[model samples]
Target: MDHSYLSSKESLDIPYITFPDLLRKWAEKNPNKTAFIFVDEEVDRYELSFGELYDKATKFAKALIGHGVRKGDVIALNGRNLPEWLIACFGIQLAGGSPLCLPYLQKKNDFVKVCSKLGRVKMLIIDPGSDGQNCQFLKEMICTDFGTNNVELPEIPDLRQVFLFNHHASLPSVNTVAELCSREWDVDLPRLDPEDLGLILLTSGTTNTPKAVPYSHHALVITAYNSIHLMKTSGKYDSLYNNRPFYWIGGFVMWEVNSGGSRVTLINAMKSSSMATAAAAVKTCEIIAREKVTVALLVPSMLDLVMKKNISLRLKTIVTGGMIVHSSLLKNIHKLCDEFICMYASTELALIACNTFTEKDITNTTKGLLSCRPLPGIEIKVTEDDGFLLPAGQRGSIQVRSTRRFNGYLNQNLPPESKETLERTGWFCPDDGGYVTEDGELVVEGRLQEIIQVFGWKKMFPFEIENVIKTKSNVSSAIVMSLKDKETGDLPPFAAIVYHPNDEESCESMQDYIRKEFNITTENRMLEYLCVPRGIVSFKQFPVLANGKPNRRAIRQIILETVDSEKYE
Candidate 1:
């Protein structure tokens, strides 16, 4: 049941081409075919034809050259899921420059400090605000619906110029997107090298600071192509619904359109104001039912909200991940959607594995991590600390190797240990602990580097123990960590939880349950020791970190000072 593949599954082969070449190919054939349908906040959907998409990108590329944007320059793009974002990105690559695709930020941080990591940014094209409550307020004050206004940038030391996308707003120094589309120029596009840097994607800093991962033109093209092939989605789907601005699947669909390979309809759920909301469950229902979206990918954070919604869905597949999904949440997703898949990936290693679930999988009693087969061209292996491969079902370090990996980090001095770790060919050890099933499926336990070495007979992973506690009554969120027992110098694990309204569960009750059911009878020595929490604490809500994961390290620091909560006895 781990890695199921029918003998009839066809061998996948993805065609690769550079951005300019792909655009030209699509524009040449079926010029009138719709390339993308962008749904705006006002519920109006605008269709951009293949010819129009290519022509606009070409004009923008020419305008970039006219404005001193040269080959090998670095330009940053900040916007929502709009045609303009794609236009600028393809234009940057067509002009032989690298486009740094930044996520839409609500609040402006220290610009000088943030921009320093980008090296020298030749120009910045940004949507002053996108579509949502946070963006609505900003858009009302700063930008037109088209996202442009003549406001001073936050003084980025390396920023040369800024461009906004509103049709009405104009500035002497700043350029409007309307001008970009029709910036009169007649110059032949520069010859692009496939190996030239095309895009820089920042890592989602779930555990640490984000790093810039550079991807070459051919690498990105092949990566996107391979992704679609792995999804096993043939022909055109009804509409590809996506919650986020940029997901790997959506990128694959875009590349499919650009490469003239497929013409599946794309539904950016975030574009329609009614679909994207500060709340999760209702928005999920609205986007799917309203758009009749056939396929989509959401994150595990949406589970709490998704469980509250009851609706009939036209969805073919619902892919979710980026955190461990509880079986309870999976039940809600399973009943609402046809197919459920868990996508396991990192910014460093894109799309490592995607495991589809079955009816039996829903009720399976195994508390271990879910299983997924590695992508066709990618290799996954389990290894011990001694640099040797481990047998199946034995937890060890996880390693992945593929040709579609990033070129390297933008800032070479990042992660300091990366040089030593990736010193070998294409193989990347993510430092996650996992075991391969006998069926060749990979199971990720958690980050081995982040595992806690509690003072005991065996060390434990906080994620494994935390997942167990989350199954408790009325628990909203749970975090497990180790605290130093000062009297005996023993480091016993502590469990902290936030409860949902109504069903009252206290620390004393949680500890008593664990001590009886876990500490007394479990024959598995490791499980018996790890599951018994030495202490339990309750918080109304967990403090969130930069990238939205619970800040366990910060919470541990606070608990160390207050109350004699570290005692195990």
Candidate 2:
């Protein structure tokens, strides 16, 4: 936790460069070096070397320019993690156009609504259907309604064309990316500026409408350098295994590719499915050991699965974040690697803070409040509702200021809450509440807006009850959130718990224990009576987002339905 050993650089010290230029630098320096490793189930995989990736991306860039992709055009790239996805993404940047990364959704209305929200998408390049024939939904939409001018579909007004991967069936009015990439076009690609819009990343649409977050080439490079700096590795041979989707900031190639280090990603056989399956996790662990991956970025869920395999994994470091690092998981870190790192980051603000825990450090630290040291170039503080800066150890709203903050959202009306959060003077509120310890470690409690109002004016953070629930011997992990009472319109807390595998308790018994614990805590005045959860739901494991954070939105819906069913019974 020493700032003296951390990576630090003034804003001017970091190099600002374009993505295409960065790719070219790597290709020239390490031409034959493996840049990307794409793995499938059963250890089947392929490698994309830097030279080959650059050559393909350049050709694809020319193809894009030939297809009328001008600078600043927002082209939608929707698909699973594949070699083609990375190539097409870099090609878009090479052509001076911004690639709008979209998840591979199957429903027609869902796809159209997401595309329409961005306003006038220039083109869409998506993968084939699960059957590998074609995107049936899109084929139906374009052929039936989008004849020639696409005048019939007002939703996607500016959509000029749709292109599927070559494996799909040939259909009328649809083009194939293979044909485009194979086209020998001599069109001049536009010159790209370092500050040009590089790519567009959508906010994880778990809670609200997915907002478009645009990052410039400069921002990408700066963050990429910071990421590489964090690995604290000098050799280019150190490999990373990351299963996060390419659309996510965590899985972004900019982070690892800049280091000239190789990265391995899990490629789901079914294109539509994005979740990392248990089979995939086992395969990932096999790849990690076989390939001798030094630093791996496995989300807590994936880590738990990998660890359950009881494989001996000794690596340089294992990086995790975007979820609460449970005590059980933290305790098992020594079995995985020499150093464990948990980060605090968001789409809006890049890498905010991280804690590097050695085995000894983990043993010495308190298990309750997880703390992180702020990264270089990031200024974070906890402030009261009135904008008063709270002293160390006093919990309040967390705000951050950084030069590398994302460019504003694109083509969407800002929600009032989002508007207020960003409109603050020189600070961006990440909607998280936490405190800073006297040692300067930042402790993130939970979401600020997720505070549950139980009685007329009594409110409590979800973590307050969650922390208490996790203290039970049988509980492995617990998530507490508020649900609106249909009858009374009050927000009361509910608990979703994952019990220890060996110490599993029956639901009836666990409920009784939870109530007893709550009663004891209330009697001792450690917690208020109103803070007790109204209902308890047990889970083998909690559902998580693609980025590996607990999926509270889905959890809330599940809890609501469970409560309703119980009442009916």
Candidate 3:
């Protein structure tokens, strides 16, 4: 593969701009152009224009300023991908304030915790009754309609004002969207610089409390622009999928699509009332086929569900990550799209490496792991535990320095993940462990901190085995963890699984299948022998942590008890 094309920023046809400034430019260039196609749960569709979106955003900015919002103040947007929610986000940013988006469906305690971390951060823009019911710290509540019939203000201290959008629920001093839009509260906003904090994305926080990652106006725009070039989309009318909610890092793809000045097609799955049920995925498929969507993104798990329905997606590029993609998924998903792209990323540093897989790249050797080509302006290094750089193909902790690095973590109290992992000179080593290919592609082996420690044995990532087990049609979820060997004090990994209730693949049959798949082979003995799973255990379902990752500790305990009570072959 040629390395020359990867070094040039000149290949990026789109010009980067501050996110707020881009809105202005788009409005001027294509006033009537459809910026968003919003579909409600009821199947109603709305086509908003660049001019209309900017007008509304400007109105909201004025309203925020009128209500005493200043530059650098925090404005939290909580909702599914609604037009008004994004308008408010742009409005806050245009008002010289920063915007932080929390998933609209978050529980009360989670919302409170995020607020607490920000140290009395007060403003919250929410969907009518989403997670705003119990955020006691919000001094002002901006509520938008998201299929809710009526809005109610729950008992919350410091939550003094209620601002409504597209509704007429009147209460004492409750402001209407109409009033805000037609108001004369105008102020001159300053021009934005690259260093201005534009967006704050919350991590999954699978291990601990969710941390806030702040990206500067420059970082967000540049990263988004880079995504377009990396994906290699044609110029105009190229439509990108907008099914994922904006709260996750996956949502950054939506911003990337917009930065390219292309179309972002939103299906019904992103509505506030949507649960992304099987029906919703089907609906999304229908839209993808109907619209001839050029690009679509999905997590590896979602690919399984989508493929089960046997939907043919008219997509040119399919972007997938979030979990190790099974071979079956890789092969089958390729049948629906032209190319399969796998990206390695984190919340703080967005896109690291991108690999576009063809039929040749779908072999068994690439099943559990695919080496992704490092993107332009991104530096990746495999370093030893003591910070020494390792040679190619030698496994070590993954560290990166890239344009996508966030401005900083929000909580000044808690030391940033960058404090230890990120050096003063600007390198960030995530907990992940992986090696690089001489070709400059990175092979990600799960997180080093999350790796199941097996004493004196080859280092193995649970994702490697878990992803393999997930390839089974009957397996709904799989978790592999190291259990304490009571006799020797050494740990060996065991597989815990949740099989489909209707499917009947027994534990014995599963064990036989695993033993056969990983049995002694004729060639590459090291490769064959290293693929060992010590034991198998069954679970009804995997316990999930607060941030939606598998509760590994709980799964290990369950597996440990199974190992203790009975001896296995």
* Model 1 lDDT per residue over 276-395, tens place: 123545555565666665666666545444554443454677777666555555555666677778767776667677778755677772456666777656777787776677777677
Ranking by lDDT: 2, 3, 1
Residue 517 accuracy (lDDT) in model 2: 64
**The candidate that achieves the highest TM-score relative to the unseen native structure:** 2
- List, residue by residue over 364-436, the lDDT tens digit for candidate 3: 4444466676777777778888777777778888877875564457764334645755546467766788877
True lDDT of residue 550, candidate 1: 64
User: RMSD per prediction, one decimal?
Assistant: 5.7, 4.4, 5.6
- Predicted candidate 2 versus true structure: per-residue lDDT over 291-399, tens digit per residue: 8899988767567666766655678899988755554667777888998888888887777778788888767674655678767787887888876788887768887
Q: Candidates' TM-scores?
A: 0.79, 0.86, 0.82
C-alpha-based local distance difference test score of model 2: 0.72
